[model samples]
Target: MTDLQIGNHLRKLRFLKGEMTQAQLSKNVGVTRQTIVALETSRYAPSLELAMKLACVFDCGVDDLFFWINLEDAKSKYSSDGQ
Candidate 1:
């Protein structure tokens, strides 16, 4: 199976927003600072509600923040059938 991963641009967005701090963003999103850190580091994935809150904070859509990375090879060698 492909090792799909979720990536985000939270750190960049925060910096773009006048160097917004993790603590401030956490407070605005009602999450712990550690949660913000985790999100920025791609160590944790946010819930849909949290994602929406973040999008609202930056006035951007969720697609602007998060993206998917498919870690599978071109031929999908990990799969039984490389279709």
Candidate 2:
């Protein structure tokens, strides 16, 4: 099975949003600055509610903020058999 990874554009989006600070975003989302750091570093995946809140803050779709990355493609080449 392929390893599915969650990726985000939090840092880029934050900068685009008036150079918003990590602390500011965390405050808006009712979380700690560390949480924002974790998000920017891709060390943590936000919960559904958190994701929604972030999207709301940016006035964008959730898909615009986060996405799925197939890690297997990055790590090695492989083929899947049709089932």
Candidate 3:
């Protein structure tokens, strides 16, 4: 299975939730701003806990906010049944 990057959706979700900044979301989600930026740019793929926190902030599900956008093809391969 291919490893998928979910960064682009993170940024979209952040903006859709109100153009929130990486720093603000990072603080809310208890991660570094650099981490948030990384998540937004495909430099990082968040762990399950971090992904859940982000979903919570966006008032959405983990899959809703991160698993099926940006790199949907890559994500689809790994999101189900833990691959």
Candidate 4:
């Protein structure tokens, strides 16, 4: 099976949103600045509630922030024949 990874566009979103700081976003999401730093660096994944909170703060959908990435070659693994 391919390794599924979660990725985000947090830093870019923050910059697009008037260069919002990690401290500011942390406060808005009721988390520590370190948590924001971890999230921006992809060192940690947010809980579902936290994800919703972040989306609410940014007025955007969760999908707009996070996405899935396959670490391995997907085409070579999962075949249409279900092999």
Best model number under lDDT: 2
Candidate numbers sorted by lDDT from highest down: 2, 1, 4, 3
**Best candidate according to TM-score:** 2
> In model 1, which residue pairs have backbone atoms overlapping below 3 Å?
none
lDDT (tens digit, per residue) of candidate 3 on 18-69:
8888889989989999998777777787889988888888888888776534
Which scores better on lDDT, 1 or 4?
1
**Residues 50-72, model 4: lDDT tens digits:** 99998888889999999887757
Clashing pairs in 3: none
Give lDDT: candidate 4, residue 46: 93
Local distance difference test, candidate 2: 0.91
Ranking by TM-score, best first? 2, 1, 4, 3
lDDT of each: 0.90, 0.91, 0.77, 0.88
- Candidate 2 stretches greater than 4 Å from native: 77-83
**Weakest 10 consecutive residues of candidate 2 by summed lDDT:** 74-83
- Residue-level lDDT of model 2, residues 1-83, one tens digit each, is 87887899999999999999999999999999999999888789999999999999999999999998888886565444332
Stretches of candidate 1 off by over 4 Å are 73-83
TM-score of each: 0.83, 0.87, 0.70, 0.82
